[model samples]
Target chain A: MKIMPCPLNGPRNISEFVHGGEVRDMPNPTTCTDREWAEYVFYSDNQAGIVTEWWLHAASGYWFIAERHTVTDEIIRTYDPSEIFNQRVEFSDETTAKEVGA
Target chain B: MSATSPESLSKRSFVYRQLAGASFRDIAGGAMATGVAEGNNNRSQAEQSALLDLSVLPRTGFRGLTAAAHLQAAGLPIPARPNQASVTGSGELVLRLSQKEFWLLGALSDSGAGVDALNQRGLPAADCYSLYCQDSHAWLALTGAHLPATLAKVCGVDLREASFPLGSIAQTSVARVNVVIVHHQLAGVPCFSILCDSAAAEYLWESLLDAMGEFGGEVIGSNALL
Candidate 1:
């Protein structure tokens, strides 16, 4: 049984988690070109070595970040999304005011 | 004495249809199974190994960036960290599922007063929103000495008393169904309160019973827990 360590709940069966796409910086939807937005939404680097990705613990509905080896499929480490998402990303046509974490 | 029939109640358990031969009682405007036809000693059976449906019991959840603060402001004792639980003076169990998500389960004796009071107070803060736990999930209590072993057949978590001690909570898959398992006690009997999607309640209940058949597990009622 493959195990996925959840930042919120402890390690659990891999079956309990859904592999969200690779984590990437979002291009401001209001400013970026439609092609840029499409690439961001529909493409993945699919790196071969260590890569950061999004994972969702289905039971708790908690999403977190995990670093794993693409070749070995070994989970290197797992941590809460707050580690990287310190600011709330806001996309607006009038103003793209992002709220930085206090 | 005759008990209330589930058909007469406006609110019924999600698995009420599977409770044939069990006597029912009124609880928080809903029908709760109080006893089974063959279980002459349900209390003892609960002490050994039994499954009790608590779907009609009062339970509410709150989630948001400020949900914990909101609950604490309401005078409820929130757990210091996620995946932990605290019992209130009135016997209500407060479970902190995440940094901002908390679930409040009313004590059996209180029916629904504790949760009702909190719900009535409303979400006075922005971002803090009330969750429809009562309508969205079905609660089941798996109690007794053989709980860990029986659960082992279906769950992957280390639910042994030593590993998953009292007050610990695990949100994981059980019998391939998503469930939140809270380790607590009811009337001094160790219990794992399993909460799952209401739509899958009957399926999960049946699966649990099938897994527990080897241990002489029996169906119990809420009265046994009280």
Candidate 2:
């Protein structure tokens, strides 16, 4: 593994991370006043994710997200966890992990 | 998993009918004493490189017990009321008290000096509890590119620098046995070395080997060391 450290962040060690929570269910901001949307946007549920959840690669020295399967441990996906929870889950039927090498 | 070194039995100072394999030798003075000498890369002493030897000084809480002879024997960590240690890089740092009870903790390297200072008990030692260190050539070095992600499979113990930081030592169970795990750098890549009884080597090996399979990782013996 080639180790590179850029002040702006190419990448950092995984050790400096904390699995924050599952990004889900935020009430749209425009639908409500500031307070209601503020609470929904900041907090998320942490379900122990024995299967999967949002992992804050806090130690990444950068802000990124890691989507991993808890049981098989094959990383289901890695994205910006913070923003990922906000992105839509593209539920598709293109089964088998080998299909798309994301 | 590879062949386990025949469990080596010998006379030593700590009072406890304990099996000292390559893993516990550092504290048992069998292998642990020479730990610093065997693999001391001066530059990374504090930088926290891969696979570190850690020791915990226990507080006599809970029900702490050793074999018997090693109870107060010279040169053993003052018996901390505890059972085994365990963990990898990503899991919890824990110690077993009974079948289910466990405590999470960590510290620096093994303190043989402190153990050596235990005042010998004065009871006419009945079948004395002996401290036997294993001399088998079973040493461990962890190798991985995604160790943090890999470690997440077994434990919820945070591996990030902010939560665990550098030079972190943890005592926990991986696959149910006691282990001492430390976070280290492998060519700047975060890696971890978790040590437990060599008898449990096969079990750990299988788990790690299984974990690495996803990454096309292969296991190499002593000759193919990292």
Candidate 3:
């Protein structure tokens, strides 16, 4: 049986997971043109080489990313998304503008 | 999270009638019973070492970033890794299915009050998580000296005491169905609780029985585990 190393669950049978497709940066819908958005959704660099992709552990429902070689079917590494995307947008709790005439 | 009603779409165990034999009574919203099979050797195995149907046992499911915090606030200790389990002071079992998903099984201990307290304190400010009753799965508890041997027939993971260990859980397949296997103990002996889709209960049950036939597998009452 093929084994896949899960970042959180350790190594497990490959069958316990689902391929989540290539991991790519999402184009900002507000600024990107229709053509760019369409390409982002439909196009992929299918050449045989190392690629980063999403993978989901079916039983645990944990989703993460794995870098693998297409030609060798070798997984180089697996990691959680939070490790790479740590910065998040948060609304400021305090107001920026001062009261004009209290 | 608001308490959701049990889903009508949820399935009942196909072995329900078989499980509802003598001494069976209505509990946990399902038929309950306990007894040894007549042909089985009582001297061979300790009492309470048998298969228990916990399909009707109440379960709560939760997932997302704030879920662990939410459960911690509800009184269940969040396991540091996926496929790990923790027990509440009141005997409730909390199993982390994945990085952000968990299931709260058994009802003796409750963090409902803690959830209420969290809500009162205005925690979980956004829609950062989700929680609901898990009525879609069937559960069975397997215990006895022969448990590992029986499980070995179907489960691919090593389940011996030294390897699987107590309180550990695995997200693996058993009898061709994806399930969660938690290694627990009953009367100081190793026990495993198998959770799978309710619709496949009968098939899995029969498969387990087939595997256990070599070691005198028999259906015992829910009280054995409850």
Per-residue alpha-carbon lDDT of model 1 for B12-74, expressed as tens digits?
Answer: 899998898788889998988888777744688889889998889899999999898878888
Better model by TM-score, 1 or 3?
A: 1
Chain A of candidate 1 compared with the true chain A, TM-score: 0.86
lDDT of 1 by residue, A1-102 (tens): 898888888889999999998999888766778799888999888889999999999999999999999999999999999899998876563543332321
lDDT tens digits, residue span B1-226, model 3: 4321223224444467555433444434444344433433232343434676666556667677777787777666887877778866655678888766877776422313333333344337653454543457777778788777788899777778787877899877787788889987644546788988777888888888788878766777544443
> What is the iRMS for every candidate structure?
0.5, 13.4, 1.7
DockQ values, each candidate? 0.81, 0.01, 0.41
Tell me which of candidates 2 and 3 scores higher on lDDT: 3
Ranking of predictions according to DockQ: 1, 3, 2
The DockQ for candidate 3, computed on C-alphas, is: 0.41
Number of the top-ranking candidate, with TM-score as the measure: 1
Instruction: Give the candidate order by descending TM-score.
Output: 1, 3, 2
Whose lDDT is greatest here?
1
Arrange candidates by lDDT, descending: 1, 3, 2
Error of 1 at B220 (Å): 1.2
Evaluated against the true structure, the overall lDDT of model 1 is 0.89
Q: Residues B1-226, candidate 2: write the lDDT tens digits.
A: 4522223434232211222233333234332222232343332332332232222221111122333224324222222332334442322233333322323332223332322333234323443232221221123445555565566676545565566554454444455555555565433445565655656655665676566556555432211122
Per-model TM-score versus the true fold: 0.94, 0.30, 0.79
Instruction: List residue ranges in candidate 3 displaced over 4 A.
Output: A87-102, B1-14, B18-22, B36-49, B107-130, B224-226
